[model samples]
Target: MQVAPRRTGEWWISPAIPAVANAALASLWAFTAFGGWGEQAFCGVDSAHDPTCATGFENAVLSSLAVVIPAVVIMVSALVLRRVRHYPDRLGMMLTAAAFLWVGAEGIVFLGGYLAQPS
Candidate 1:
């Protein structure tokens, strides 16, 4: 029985969606970018030397939540916001903001790579 906030009457989105989206974007970029589950993950790492599951792991993308964790967080947060916006608990909103900021910061930091669009 929770009601969503009305739009600004100019835009089509709630504005919060973008932050959550950015969180997902950042997470995808971080978790699966560069060499996350790179060639090493699929085919192999070296032809001359076989990967031992410990040597080149250092080169893999480092996310505390592995791969799917961040995505789950973003999705769950979105659902929670849609359902609990009317609740008095501010923790959900705070988490959404924090996730957005984390992603935005990562985007800014790696702007030279992922941020660059193919022109």
Candidate 2:
């Protein structure tokens, strides 16, 4: 009986990709949580007594986690697949690629929302 050789084309899905993705997501989450972008909007309201603007600002900042949480999950899954033995290489690569794209999309959406808001 002859054993088939494993494919080597999936070398790009290394452990570093997930690790870097995790870091990127963490940084974005921290940036939003700390009001890096939303602070301006929060403070731009002309009326100091109006509560609606403050609430909108709060919601915008909090809503960022909607993207961060799933990105974290995907990052963790990719990391786990990279570490575990006998995990399918193609599946791991696909997950990592998808996660990377998702994170990119999330970042774009976050930026768009921030830019689109009235100052």
Candidate 3:
């Protein structure tokens, strides 16, 4: 028998917290990737090898994975808890997991591309 949720309409809270956390992490990653703290900026979205940007593309990509990976792990864990373990307030879990997974996979791809580029 499945237990009813404790709160009447608070299922949003679980996903909201993770979404906000991911947003914050994304912001930080963007800042670092764009040279927010005196570091050279990475190439822009429209130009992957812009002459003005920094040459350390791999480093920027790696750092972004540092942010994306953890958020993905957390969201995946929450999804597993809600689906397999039958945790409560699971309303937004799937969406949250999907968003995180998409972002994380993109980060991995970006990292791979930079890593494979000629030095």
Candidate with the greatest lDDT versus the true structure? 2
Worst 10-residue lDDT window, candidate 1 = 110-119
1-111 per-residue lDDT for model 3 (tens digits):
232355785323455555565566566555655543313323445445454333456455665566566666666665566463364345355446646654674465456
What local distance difference test score does each model get? 0.45, 0.54, 0.52
Against the correct fold, how does model 2 do in TM-score? Answer: 0.49
After superposing candidate 1, which stretches have Cα over 4 Å from the reference? 1-13, 19-63, 66-74, 81-83, 86-95, 98-119
lDDT of 2 by residue, 56-109 (tens): 545655565566566666656654664542464554564565456556645654
* Order of quality (TM-score): 2, 3, 1
Clashes of each: 0, 0, 0
Residue-level lDDT of model 1, residues 1-119, one tens digit each, is 23365565532334455455656766565554443443234324456333433233333334323433554565466557655544434434544555655565444434323222223
| Alpha carbon lDDT at 88, candidate 1 | 30
Model 1 lDDT at residue 80 = 71
Q: C-alpha displacement of 68 in model 2, angstroms?
A: 2.5
